[model samples]
Target: MRQRGREGLREQRPVATMEAAEGRLSSEDSGEMGGGMAAAAVEGIMERIQSDDEECRVQAAKEIRRLTKTSPKHRRQLEGTVVPLVSMLRSSNPEFTEAAMLALLNLAVKDERNKIKIVDAGAVEPLIGFLRSTNSNLQEHATAALLTLTASSINKPIVSAAGAIPLLVKILRDGNLQAKVDAVMALYNLSTLPEDINTILAAKPIPPLVNLLKICKKSSKIAEKCTALVELLLGHDEGRMALTSEEGGVLSVVEVLEEGSPLSREHAIGALLTMCESDHCRYREVILNEGVMPGLLELTVQGTPKSQSKARSLLQLLRKSSYSGSELQAETLENILTNIVAQIDGDDCVGKAKKMLADMVQVSMEQSLRHLQKRAFATPTKQSRTKRQ
Candidate 1:
């Protein structure tokens, strides 16, 4: 039996030899392993982060932040390192907080496991509180981390339930530009579900959100996100009422349609369409009073089919509220046909179409005024008689 065992061991030698020849065998003779070196580096940084020396902690944090941003490899072995990093967030030391937050931000980004680990380490609450930080950098970094953590399916409600929503809205309202953008994006992600939308609306954020739209320049990234947020906010019952209640909402949306990105315009059209879908007479008059009907009309000719469809749907809703169907369609068709003829005759289609709609709106307004004046003169009150005299 011993002799057969020796023969079997000897037969395995060829396989080991083959593995070595293919460079598949772990070998000390191959020099220091990159994995070993990386592990050692991470362990050393972990020690520095926990060091009594504050400078060492900051340096370690900066190094860790750089490493995490460049790759996720070091994060795989982050178990021993996460606690000190999270603890540093509560430090009275602002540098420590910023460094730790940046390190954690980079560490948590694009790594769901790391995000879970950070949240498990009790990072979410402090992060939420930090959203109100007077330190813009810290606010920015904390928002970035929460944005990543909230993206985790497991962490979404954990974040919202922890009171992150209202603070996030505050950040969206008053934080620095980048902080506002980050906060708005975080809110956008959190507002993905119906429940999340209700939670956000309960925070009463529509006015500030509309303010954000006005504060950001036209065609800016922040404007795009604010427009998108309005689209979602319009999806909820409270959200729609909140939007309609906010005096700036309709005009802000219309401004986006005229000046924002293509996606912004598309979303603006959808949001207007949403407003018109609600049976409330005030909602229809709200957008119409913004004088956006001409822009809405232009969209029928120039918008994507989906947005054009939305524009047409909105026009149908608006016209139903104010005009008889046949009259409205005849006016719209006459304007479109005249613009089409001019377009074929080498005139700018947009220019001609806008002019045609302007003329059509003018005619409609004149006829409506004539009817109102006739009704008024028919009554002929005392004040009217004085004016007539």
Candidate 2:
């Protein structure tokens, strides 16, 4: 399979050699490609994955991926290849680890059998370890792989057991921008678990995340990630309780929303809307006390499409909260409603506030009906019943 020419070493294969082998390999009657030239080529490629030269290793890993993708039989036979590639995860060379990761990504693509195979090979732990690496690209790709694997509902428990939250939070604060983006996505997914979300709250991830939201408001990509994290946080009861903790709770996020990055403003708006759905009375007061309407109006008039949508959404949420419009500053409410009309004319934002207005109006009418229903259902005997109780 290898020719030792004057140049040192070269791949020399006779024409039709692989074709003949391909036919044999495809035939169920024939055994796997054992003790043959195909096996030798596979070995050569695997060996090159460990080459001292970085480029050679990367090239070899790419070839291995291509080879494995070509035939089901080839992939099954090369299942053992995961061992060497996974070992590269610990290599001092980031390039080697990256190439190995790319190869592993392809390896996991063959089928469910391969996916479980790689998972069983103990790849996740080491991959999570790379979250600590200072190399931005490695962190990004490794986190992406983990995100894919951990996407399954069964994997939620596994991810929590792996201590992914603290590591992810660390990346959020210290890693480069790409790393922060990846970390945010992982956290968003992991937040599906109540226990895992508690882990994030324990790490005090919200404050730094709020800080990041402020800094990254202009970046649409980062802003979207920030919004996702907020959505996840507010989705769970534990997460909401944590956010509304006395140290500031929901109020802290409101502070960030008002003072944060424009992108963060959008994300903050969405988070607040979700939280408002089930907020305690005090939490509802926090939103009104923060004076959200005027700031939201400003954002609607001057913010980006996402920001304008977020601001408008927050206005609708505030309107829906337990804080009755009568309790709110009437002038501020008017400004916000006007800004919504102005936004419709300006068209700076891509997302719309039309649905929000309808939702708020519906919620308002529903609340009013509930109040009237309660009063109408009351009987004169209720006063006597209450006194007895």
Candidate 3:
């Protein structure tokens, strides 16, 4: 009986050796063991992220979120994680898909480099897809993430090129109000670049931007951003024309100047001033008779040195316009000149006023000389014709 048991043990040992040889066991080698362990860990994460099991997906997402905050290397891990996570955005279960998307949005905030990587890895399509979701929360987070990504100077042009602007603009008009606000804010930042701006403004984007300003007058954040965008739009000639167009162009601006918030007032004034500079001769009567004079005058007294300077500049613009010097009451001219002289009185802002005043004087002198030349060149009447008669 002892001999039979020994034979059985020897046969079992051979079977174990065959199994080890077939599996290619290498645990005895330290380098191979370490590499195998690392590979297995990565495979495990990939499987969990891809798993249909809700628990597996949630745990993987949570772990990735944690890793994103760990270190730069882990942030780079986001580059890999985003690909699978983006796919998960299409999941049938709203909870699982939303969990995946939030994780992706979290990864996007890690850094600019990570943002570029995510963008390069095709994050735009997924994000735009999420915009169609019925979930307002998803829209908010996705829009916020898109805003951050678009905020990067390097990524801005890329974002524009990826065809996100039109979609973003849609969100501004139709999405949840918060999403609309966020989208407009992003559009403002994105519009600073010529490539992005010219495309949207060429499509007549100013009217909508103007409407937004009217709607958000009481919201400081919205007002500030809206003012900045108005300023930028005012930088272009087409934009000025759009604002002061027959559709209450300059008319809309006048209302803002009258009733808008201080920030809105400042920007509205600045935009009007810029437009006045464009065609002051043509728009002079329109400005003065419309009650812009008092606003311009008050600005000089109550504004910052910068705003005071801007007010003075606006007056200078008005002065350049064809005022009926022959018809303008002397008192009006005197009042304007007096306000200008007062501004030049301030040590801080005087330099700017002095420069402007000198330029005006030079222009006046040139006009006067031309007038004198024309008078001197007048032809003599024919006195001989009367003698012949």
Candidate 4:
């Protein structure tokens, strides 16, 4: 009787287990079916987008905007839809134009190929037109779209040639907050091309850029790009003069050096270095007045390798200028250097710090000699010119 009871329990177990397993399989099948249905829906939308019916095209563009906003897979699969979307950018209706631009921006987010394709489809000229649009939303979207498209190195020249820089500078001066931020980033991207630097400078971007940097967070991405662009701009005399002329411009860069991220601090220091190097007598006092010592000292120990090197160099420059033939000033600089080296090498490594200081002095002396030699050779005295004659 006990053996028969055991056999009866085993016979009932399979029936319940089989039903549970079948239920899981049915759910998985439904999930796959749902995915298939979604793909089919996207296909239908693409068909509508390509058709000659204006209403269908408008609805389809809206749907593409929604679908591609958060779906990387859809963006990849919809590459062929780029030309149609670019065509919609020329629509007279504001809503249609915005929807198409937003969709194109979304599609270009992470896909490099889509960015190039969109630019190749002649989307740039219309986008430039939208940059001057009376509708704020369209202008913002146009700036953002150019920001995305110019991120591709191949599209930089194409967008630049379409007369986008002047309009971008205009946006920097007059557009809303978001548009200003996007315009700066787009300009930064274009500035990567060696040839576009002058073109950007010609737009008189410094005052607006300085204002933007002054208002934004020091550690934010916008600040990083702003400083980076400012650094690039410093390569030209017009850019350098523009920055110095802008109110609070030098102070803004000094603030970044003190409180910004590592990359930003690097850029900030670079901008300062550029100014001081360009015309040391003119800018040395200008930079020192901004109270840049604390940030420069901190960066000596805490910054990236390139930044640390720059910090040391800038500190040397500032130190040399700060000396007024007074023992008090000399002692203060000595104490500052001692503190930096101690922080770098610790109390136990005093010998190492001494060696490092010696090396720095040696390097500075070598640099001074080179500068004197350059001045000697670059300009000829009366005797040398007479000899040449």
Candidate 5:
């Protein structure tokens, strides 16, 4: 079997072996044209992938894995290999089946064309089937394959239609740490589309997902993906309720915004923005009371373009909440006070209005002075930086 894979690789070597010559290219090598495999090489691998002997097929699948990993061209050229891989996914031999699934997983690696081929070849159902297998390794590989397949914009619905959500949720609740990460990461990707949010939420993954967010180390990739998933989930009403109902729910998100990785912080802000925009008055008030303004203001100055936009929008919402739109809006505190003063008469009754307006102006001035002092402290020198909450 090993000899067979070697022979198969040897047939493809002229193009595949160019890496060997990369370091010592004489003038003749510079003139040599690039190369690729003949059809026979693919045929040999495909034949070995389906060989009656189990070891031979595993060897073939592994060679395919290596080729797919090393060469993007091999991944794209896998039109013939995907069909056999998809078929072998259902094989009764667990070891061979695992090998085949992993090979397909590798082939689908960041290669959208191969991903499409795997999906169209009917790999979803069998992969979802593996999720329920007593074999944890098989489950891990299957989750990984589903994760890769979902990266394509078109494959999310396909995987979801195959009833992957509930199975993935089960893995989230029961699988090893690595498997749990892959499962939530896939859920995060699926939730990228509004249409899939219902599918994910219907699976009831929120409890475990929120738990995942809370228990994982701060700013880790798992927590990052979990936060991103919750951010998307928060767009729906049910999602919002589930999240807030969880212990440390809103605060968990806020903590991530305060200290997670830059990407996690971005997602965390997105989640908070969704909450602040909710029609539920409690949502906005909770965020405001959480002392999010200072952190959001910091983001407006130092965050990425999108993060800055979101932070500014949230800050504007908070400001709008401070004085209801029904009460008034003005370019500045002076404008509002000027309007009030113009409307007031010298009557004793109007003294209350003038006094109220004067109080507003004084409070505004004090707050502005505080902001200036805070900014001065936060930005006095190149090394000075504000801490966010």
Candidate 6:
């Protein structure tokens, strides 16, 4: 009786297996059917976008924006729609232009190939034109599109050559808050190229950028980009001059050094170091007058490795700038050390501050010696291995 019961259960297993297989087949078929529908929808949207009628094109662009906003698959399928979307940007109608620009922007997001494709389709010129639009929304969208496009390295040179820098600077001065933010990011992206630095400076970006940084939170991402660009710009004499000319520019950078994120602090210190290194006589007093000593001292102890190194170098330069000749330099260094300690901890805690600084310097020297020893030992080991080989 038990054997018979087992046989009955075995017989029922095949029916269950058939039912599960059919369910899986039905699921796969539905997925394929859904994909086919999506593909068809994309095809219809593309055709309408390419139509000669303005209304049809506008509607299509709107659909493209809607579709690409949330669907990566739609973005890829709609790649061929770029040329038409770019063409729509030339429409006299602001609504038409914005719809198309936004659609292109959405398509470009996270799609490197589409970014290049949009630019290659001649999107930069119209985008720059929109940067000058009287319509705030249009101008903001245009700035955003440029910002998105410039994020691609390949688009940087092309966008720069299309004469976007001056317009971007203008936006920094006159655009709404969001537009200005996007403009700064776009300029930073372009500034990554070595050749574009002078162009950026020629537009006198320091004042506006300095003002922007002053208003923004010190640790915000925009502040990081602002300081980074400022650091790069200071490598040029004109840039340094412009910064000094801008009221509170140097002060703003010092503030970042004291209060910004790790990378921002690195840039802030680097900009100061560049100024001092370029011409200590001209810039040293300017920097020290801003109460930079406290931040420099703090950075030496607590900042990133790069920031720490830059702080030490700048501090050394500041010390040297105090007096000429070796003997006077030695005396000046001691006086400056006393001043730094006093500044940080007041007269009462000078002794304690000095002790702490001494301990930090000692630890730094010990680490340097260890690093040098490792390199020294590594050289001989490599040489002996070469000989053995």
Among these predictions, the greatest TM-score belongs to 4
Which has the greatest lDDT?
6
Residue 288, model 5: lDDT of: 47
Model 6, span 53-73: residue lDDT tens: 988898888877866764567
Each candidate: RMSD: 19.2, 18.6, 25.2, 19.6, 14.5, 20.7
In angstroms, give how far residue 229 of model 6 lies from its true place: 0.9
lDDT of 3 by residue, 59-90 (tens): 89776655553344555544667777877766
For residues 1-389, could you state the per-residue lDDT of candidate 2 as single tens digits? 01111121111211122122111111113233333237777778767876677788778776666555445666666677777788777778887788777667655543446656666777788888888777777886676566545545555577779888898888887876655655666677677777777788777676556545544433244555566676677776766665655343454355445555665566677677777766645455456544454456567666778777766655655656543443221433444655666656654332344444433443243444344345335673321111110
Can you tell me which runs of candidate 2 are displaced by over 4 Å?
1-59, 62-80, 92-95, 105-115, 134-141, 152-154, 235-270, 289-291, 294-389
Give the winner by lDDT: 4 or 6.
Answer: 6
Q: Higher TM-score: candidate 4 or 5?
A: 4
Model 1 spans with C-alpha error above 4 angstroms: 1-37, 74-80, 323-389
Q: Which residue pairs clash in candidate 3? A: 243-249, 244-249, 244-250, 245-249
TM-score, structure 1 vs. true = 0.74
Better of 1 and 3 by TM-score: 1
TM-score quality measure for candidate 3: 0.61
Pick by TM-score: 3 or 6, better one: 6
TM-score of each: 0.74, 0.55, 0.61, 0.76, 0.70, 0.75
Task: Kindly list the per-residue Cα lDDT of model 1 for residues 63-140, writing each as its tens digit.
Answer: 777665535565566656778999888888888888888778767766777878888999998888787778887777
Ranking by TM-score: 4, 6, 1, 5, 3, 2
* lDDT per model vs. reference: 0.67, 0.58, 0.58, 0.72, 0.67, 0.73
Kindly list the per-residue Cα lDDT of model 4 for residues 1-389, writing each as its tens digit. Answer: 00111111111112122112111111111111112226677688789988888888888887676666655677777777899999989989888787788778877876788989999999999999999998998998898888888878889999998899999999999998778877887898899898899999999999898877766667666677789999999989999999887766787798778767788899999999988888877887677655465567668777999998988788667655533331122233346656866767777655654444443332233334343344335543211111110
